[model samples]
Target chain A: MIRQFGLPEALAILSGVQATILLSLIAFVGGGVVGLAVALMRTSERTWLQRCAGFYIDFFQGTPLLMQLFLVFYGLPVLGYKVNPWIAVAIGFTLHASAFLGEIWRGSIQAVPRGQTEAAYALGLSYASRMRNVVLPQAMRISVAPTVGFMVQLIKGTSLAAIIGFVELSRAAQIIASATYKPLLAYGCAAIVYFVLCFPLSRLSMRLEKRFAVKT
Target chain B: MTYQFDFSVLLPYWEQLLRGCWLTILLSAISISAGLTIGILTALAKRSRFTTARIAAGTYVEIIRNTPFLVQVFFIFFGLPALGISFQPWSAAILALSLNCGAFSAEVIRGGIDAIARGQYEAGTALGLKPLQIFRHIVLKPALRIIFPALSGQFVLTLLTTSIVSSISAEELTSIAQSIDTLTFRSFEIYIVATILYLTMSFGFATLFKLIDRVYFSYPVK
Candidate 1:
């Protein structure tokens, strides 16, 4: 028997939004930390470090995130690293986001004019201080729009966590669809919830792009 | 770190893995061709004079762009069946992938079109060109040329996304890898091979895209 999906059912599925949002938050923050380090390495003067970082970025960027998640979830145990689904997804999404964000941040850092860096050097600013004080601030300004834009992609990327058996929004939608056998209602509700979540960020990204475009 | 890696178990399934790679590439190709056609049409509808056409196209793009492809796949597969319009897993996956990527590529194409200046068309009109010829020569070609890099990036991404189709049990690389993992019980080694296959495909496709760019899109300056 096909059950009718009511407000209660929709609400139950919508409840998965928290898990989705939480997963995105963890991935973004975790990815941001790793991305900064990798971006710095990619932009560093050391050839070996640069090549290693480049390889890391290319490896992550080229492969499917689904595979990456699978590898981390299933493959790690072979190497004797214990991994639950949650930890697996955390590592996977963080790694995936870092690769993309590292590329973005590297471009942003390199975008800062050479004159400014040269001026900092002339002023006796050390490498660390130059980046922390003079360079990163400028790069952060250039990066805000792209970074926020990437946040939208990161949120969408979290949906893949469902494949690893995390009960995030996408997975919860499937569960609801199968449970009720009213997939039209269940998946319809899922799409609506995702739209509500992502549309605003997309618009904000466009607006930020426009604003930044004007400034530069 | 003393774990012994048993990659030898994977050698037996080499044919399956190769076939899976071919299937993955085929899926990406089919989706991208259909998706790009849809994108061009959607981009046109979006810029069309009719308000209804514009809004309808706008809504479709926004809805698809904002939602996750996995949810979109579920909706098209399981949800459509509830309404008595079911598709097999492969067809459903291709439909979802094309629609999802179409929305994105529409934006890319639209951006390219909009970047062209009004004066260029005016200049074409003054040169006694028909509207169609002007659009072909002065607008579409250059717009496509400019968006080639963005299009290439999207191509790589669409190729990666084909792996997501494995969730719906499509007979792609990831699904094959999963089957082999269970049979061989050498999950890490199998996945490592699978990852390398994907990396090779990605690089291979990117080089092909670049070649296509140079051959078809590049124009010599006078």
Candidate 2:
């Protein structure tokens, strides 16, 4: 018996929201940590470190996130390393997010006036102290808006986890769309759900950009 | 812990991969052109004096922007069939990609328009230029040069998003790589080569855009 597209199916698809949010959290939290290190590496004095970090950012930014996910989920198995779908998706999303966030943060770091770093060095402040004290505080101001902007992107990015059969929001919608024979209703709800999730963040980022511009 | 890296296995599938890459280029080129045209219109709409025009354009940009491109693709590819208007995968992919790209470019172009100073418009008006002619000659002419970098970046992004079209079985590079991987079980090697192909495409597109920016918008070296 063919079923009608109804509230029940919409709710069923909506149930996947938790999974979507969870995956975004995993990617953002993990990517933020790794990305900070990458940002530091990119801005480091050592030529080799900066070049390696540059290559990493360029590579990740240049390729599609879909390819990166496939590489982790399918490619790793060929190297005889078994990865669960969760691990694979997390790894893939983290790597992709890190490259972008790293670059964003690197730009923010560079925006901090060189004189501040020089002053810190004159005060016998080491790299960690200089970053922790002088540069990062100012860079944080420059970073907040773009960082929030990237987070909005990161949330939307988790949707591609569906490509790995991870049963996220987009995949869940696809399943219902096929089963209920109502792709319009199902995917329509899916798009609305994403809008609800992303629109506010974009607004907040814009607001933060204005606020930060005045302060900086 | 022994892993034998094999780039040679992919050599045999070069012709197939090349065909896929060509299709990717074709899809991106069509969408970028279509998307930019739509982008320019919507950008003007968003800036229109009519409230309704502003609202409609704003909503269109928001819906497309906030949603994931993958969902947008599936919605058009599968959802429209039920509405009694159906499309082949390629057409559906193109439509969704264009709409998505157009929405983002709308924002870029709107920013470009907003960046133009009020004085420029007044200067044209004082010189007896009509509203339309002032915009065409003074406002948009300068705005395009400023937004070229952002638009080109978006163009490269559209190229990458083309990879997602493979989900609809559009036979792009990623899709071809998928089938080849299954046939050879060289998943790692196949995807690595595919990744490099994509990287090269991105770099090539960026370079082409740089050249275009130079030729079309070259201001006397300031």
**Docking quality level of the chain pair in candidate 1:** high
- Residue A60 of model 2: what lDDT? 95
Q: Name model 2 segments beyond 4 Å from true.
A: none
Candidate 1: clashing pairs of residues: none
lDDT score, residue B145, model 1? 92
* Ten-residue stretch with the least lDDT total in model 2 chain A: A74-83
Question: DockQ of candidates 1 onward, in order?
Answer: 0.80, 0.81
Off by over 4 Å in 1: A1-4
Q: What is the lDDT, from 0 to 100, of the residue B171 in candidate 2?
A: 75
